[model samples]
Target: MGLAERRKVMGYSQERFAAVVGVDRTTVGRWDRGETTPEAIHRPKMAEALQLGLAELDALLTPPPADFPECTASPPCDRHGSEGIDDMIRREFLRIMVVAGSLTTLAPDDADAIAEAVDRGSAEDFRLMNGHLWQVYQLARSKSSVNTVVKDQLGALNEALKESSRAGGLYEVAGDLFQLSGELSFDGNRYTDAAASYALAAEASSHARAYDLWACALVRHAYVDVYERRYTEAAETLDVARRVAKRGNSALSTRYWVASVQAEVYAGLQDLGACEKALGEAQRVADLATPVHPGGWLRFDGSRLAEERGARYVQLGRLDLAEETLRRALETKTLSRGQSFRRRGAVLVDLAAVGAKRHDAEQVVTYGGEALRLAKKTGSGYIARRLQALQGDLRTCRRNRRVVELNAEINAL
Candidate 1:
């Protein structure tokens, strides 16, 4: 049965179903008409609203022709294997929307519609949309689909930006969107794009006077400069970010977080004393207890000190120190969660990079393999870049089939 039929069977009017699903009535109409499908992620909630078991609801929702990839291809199983296929297809479909908008310029009306959708969208919507875009961005880079994918989303992104500015004003929303945009650009290796996005993010945060958000953007922007080997520019950017952070919020730990990042910028500039001093300052700020983090994404509650220290040592080519600090950091796994997979994986990649510099292929393979796994799981560009930098070391291990696989994976990423 179609959605409308199923809802009627459950004694739910279209209006009731729409209300239960937290969507508009028109959205329900679209679902009933099969013009659009409910997101897989929302299936469980939909099932609950229909008073059906999650599995049973899914079975009922499944289109006869769709069959879901696994049910048709795989051997029958006790559980519904179609769920996995459904998720994969859903993920790819969302990714395609972002890519299509980015590669082929969206129609003016379509662009406007996307803008409206974003402006009125919840954080959950942004997460679902951007998460898929990020995955595609990862695959596109590895598969050399860069031109087609990255270019296609630009028009929609521009439209989204205009809408974000109009709707977000000078507050958290604006800062959040700016940071997301900056990170996306940075992931694509478009440093200039990253810098521009970060600049606007910082400005918006400043208008809201949110110290942490502003400082985080500055730090993100500094990363681009660091990547370009422009140490002076990176240091200057961090310095400015630091000053703003210090003045804006004494209650906030953003200054300290920026201080930690700045330490690396100092290391990049070969300023050992300044780097150490900044580290000390970061520790001092981190010592304070806070009930809540100001910004969800910008939370630098000072818990990542070990990783920060390891990163600094890595920058200085002090492999021994880097390994020790990174190992210690890994020991404190409490700070590392699913969301922090990308950050922890980055540290692992750096450690592997250090092992590579020392011609320790065993160490490289051990750490690099794990890091590569994490990179694939998280789609982290930072980790991928670090692995890329270890190419020279991989060459030294040409005879090892494991290293061959590692190189292929890193190259693919």
Candidate 2:
């Protein structure tokens, strides 16, 4: 029997059932209509309310569709011919984009193929494709321009959840995609949207039993609080995230990431001792030889610790420590090689802020100028925001011609 039928057999009205399950009536309605499934946290409560065992509840919640086909061929049979498949995928992509409130032009054929793979390809194929999309998003000059494609892919992933036989894998992928959506929103300064996405990602990851993914979602959520200067709230969130990460795979860098972000939050709170302790914990990630980062979703490999430490020191008003650490960060191969413009730009801006604090016009002009160029070239609002923060310190050197010119350039941005 289906969920609705089973609920009726148990003599519970939808309203009473929702009350028992601790959810809204519409959530129960959505479950009955197959619009959404019960989250993992709700499943046990639902089963107890319906007088069903865990396995029986799962079966009722996810009944196999009557028309699902069995593939007898050596290779999986394509229900839609190859040519028809492309057209169908394109239409689906466009429809999803419209539904997502985006009016983007069609993505190229390669991107279309990636979207199609999310629907019909193997689990590994989905992982690889999603990773590639993330790499593209990171390296792209215009981060906001990548949002449309990310939204489209998210739509495709939601559709895939409906028909996918591999429930665990699909849920994990959904978690990753939702986190990516949160990142895009965060980059655009949409804190509310970003928080919602991160919450959904945590739910999806819980359903998939992906411990690391769930912890990562919580960390991202804490970032929204951190950005708004709610240090205590962010610290509370990070405390939970740290616990969750501890339960994740030891081979993964999840716990270390939690430590890293916790350090940032501690710095925001101006607790230098707590910040230093957290940074020490985060540094252990560098020793882990095999960090598991599936699809590049959890890419914290301790490579950014120097810059992160520097930024934290800057926030704590330790200019002497900040300068030394930030200068070390700038000399790191990653920044010196020019492989990541965003990373290099952020470090440069921090150094300029240090110079501005000391009322050193030449040092401020030198570093701030390059950072501005990178912000313009990369269309990185993250860099632009950092530069704006630095601008407040530049007021001390307003009489200097170079400082005035730099301020004008930043104002133009």
Candidate 3:
């Protein structure tokens, strides 16, 4: 058992544990995520709370070897037993092999070495690489640049699906891969392809009995409708997502992320009360004691809640709320490393839109110019798309020379 498991054994919520250790709640989250270590002074208190001696606490803190999946560092252990672990490794290894290309093509000795390593639990190799690819996708300047890797992963997953049984854990991996593929399609503005990918993801997640993954896929599918301006259809789809998420593991922020997107759908439908309620549900993610997301599939964590809420406010034509909330989101971005180019870019565009709607050319040029630079720098079609959508609002400030110039630059993009 690790610190998270031990803390639960000791009946300490993450908040209580952090308070006992004299640290912020998020600091505890970082520790649970293995992103940071406790200071020496904090270790003793941590050990005491976890009911472990200092040396034993150190052992718990030490990561499992890169080869083994002793346990994932976050979300705690939901599956138990050696049989479950073995089945998971067996199928996951199939995926790993496919990612490495044809196994038979490998030198005989190299192939033999991999077979031996699998017995010693080398599935972590594939697991970590999958997680790394997600980080790469999130941080890459050009979102579409991750397509080749995603396509390869999809090929592997489809192959695995051919022989794998339901509930064998490969389905969960399939769910993850399908979501990544959908994201790539969405970034390329292929809404139909994205929707199809999400549907497959949902099907895989359902077969796996992974409620969180299943719910998130539905949310993404609904977003395709939202993007096409089908607010009624999107709202209907998101309502189903919310129900599925209620069946999800509450430890993860799956429901909250669904609620977050639902807020956007409601905003599009011009239901201010429903939008506010959904945002409130999303905010409840912060009240959870453990890390909100696994950083792999469900990355809600409430880190971008401010920005999303602000954006929804913009959609609802509440300029004052949008401006104040988005400004707070900007300030909040500095505190968390989880902020991405897409996230911040979306926020800047909303702020710029707020300015346009209010007929404030200074706000328009100031925020819009910065957003334009991000669009160019990251080559993010999402940012450029947001900018394109703001053109009609820009007419309100057409008299401003800087606005005219910025419009020209955006047009070029």
Candidate whose TM-score is highest: 2
Quantify how close model 1 is to the true structure by its C-alpha RMSD in Å: 9.6
lDDT tens string, model 3, 1-413? 76677788889889988899876686687677775556455788888777779999889888886554567657555454433432342344335434333422432543323233332232343355568778889878888777645544444444443432221455566677768777877877768767877887787677557889999999999989987779999989888888998998888899988889988999998999999898899999999977778886688888778888889989999999899999888777452343577777788888999999999999998888888998898888888888888887999999889999999998998
| Cα lDDT over the full model 3 | 0.75
lDDT for each residue of candidate 1 in 43-139, tens digit (9 for 90 to 100): 7778887777877876776677534344453466524444543233223333433433342243343332233444556434544444555554434
Every candidate's lDDT: 0.66, 0.78, 0.75
TM-scores for all candidates: the values are: 0.61, 0.69, 0.68
- List, in order, the clash count of every candidate structure: 7, 0, 0
Question: Which residue pairs does candidate 2 place in steric collision?
Answer: none
Q: What is the lDDT of residue 230 in candidate 2?
A: 96
- The alpha-carbon deviation from the true structure for residue 129 of candidate 1, after best TM-score superposition, in angstroms, is 13
Off by over 4 Å in 3: 1-126, 163-167, 333-339
